[model samples]
Target: MIPIKIPREEKLEIIANIQNHFYREMSDEIGDLAAENLLDFMLKELSPHIYNQAIKDARTTVEQKMMALEEDLYALEKPIR
Candidate 1:
């Protein structure tokens, strides 16, 4: 759960690491079978959990950012404009 904002290229590298370390441990055929199972698990179980958590986190972060932006805008505005 490290929250790091990375560029798209770095994200791909992270994904490659995940696949190489975790998924690639199995044989190709077995990995394919497991991938289908993993996809089903994600759709049925993992996705809801991830989606809900992400939504909650995003809402909080966006709210905080919006408030900060509003404060900055107010500070920057010209009087009686």
Candidate 2:
């Protein structure tokens, strides 16, 4: 799978959130660089699993819609004399 690439501004926002989480929860101050590195690591390691789950969700939704469409089409069929 291709690497997930987040826009620079969004990446910055995520890094800031990570830093804040660490500071608030862990009571440890993390620098911007450290936060960025951690973000990169997480994106690399976790993105594929997340992407696969999203695909599964989309497939299930499409299958359900297709079944509904099939029922609608069957309802429109003319009755045999």
Candidate 3:
């Protein structure tokens, strides 16, 4: 076993730097994991629901527009087809 003689002030500074680096890395890792989980949940649960609602809304709007256009066309006098 090698005997280590670290001065108190130097030891404190080294410890502080090591702790800061550790916490920074940990925070980054946790943030990435959280973002990935959130994206996965949104894709799995929320995206499909939102996509379906948008489709339903689009269909309703298209049908209403078609109906209105048909009525307008009927009101116009048509030339010989």
Candidate 4:
């Protein structure tokens, strides 16, 4: 699998958020490098699962639409004598 490469701007934002969370929630300070490493770790470990779940969700939605379309087509049939 290809590595997730976040843009520098967005990565900086995420690192800031992580540092803030550590300070507020854990009352511990996290350095910029530590926060960035944590972010990279999460992306590597969690992104594949998240991406797979999203594909599953989209597939389910398409299946539902197909089923509804089939039913609608049946409704359009004329009654036979």
Ranking by TM-score: 2, 4, 3, 1
Best by lDDT: 4
Q: Compared with the true structure, what per-residue lDDT tens digits does model 4 show for residues 2-81? A: 88788999999999999999999999999999999999999999999998999999999999999999999999999999
Comparing 3 and 4 by TM-score, which wins? 4
Model 1 agreement with the true structure over 17-51: per-residue lDDT tens digits: 54565645753333444544554454566566777
Clashing pairs for predicted structure model 3, backbone only: none
Which rank order by lDDT, best down to worst?
A: 4, 2, 3, 1
For each candidate, what is the lDDT?
A: 0.64, 0.96, 0.64, 0.97
Give the residue spans of candidate 4 off by over 4 A: none
Write the residue-wise lDDT of candidate 2 on 1-81 in tens digits. Answer: 899989999999999999999999999999999999999999999999999999999999999999999999999999999
Tens-digit per-residue lDDT, 1-81, candidate 3: 123445767755555555556568775333444544444554567666777799999999999999999999988967886
Error of 2 at 45 (Å): 1.0
lDDT of 3: 0.64
Worst 10 residues of 2 by lDDT: 1-10
Give residue 33's error in model 1 in angstroms.
Answer: 3.2
**TM-scores of all candidate predictions against the true structure:** 0.47, 0.96, 0.53, 0.88
Model 1: colliding residue pairs: none
Residue 53 in candidate 1, Cα distance off native in Å? 0.9
| Candidate 2: segments with Cα more than 4 A from true spot | none
1 versus 4: better lDDT goes to: 4
Clashes of 4: 0
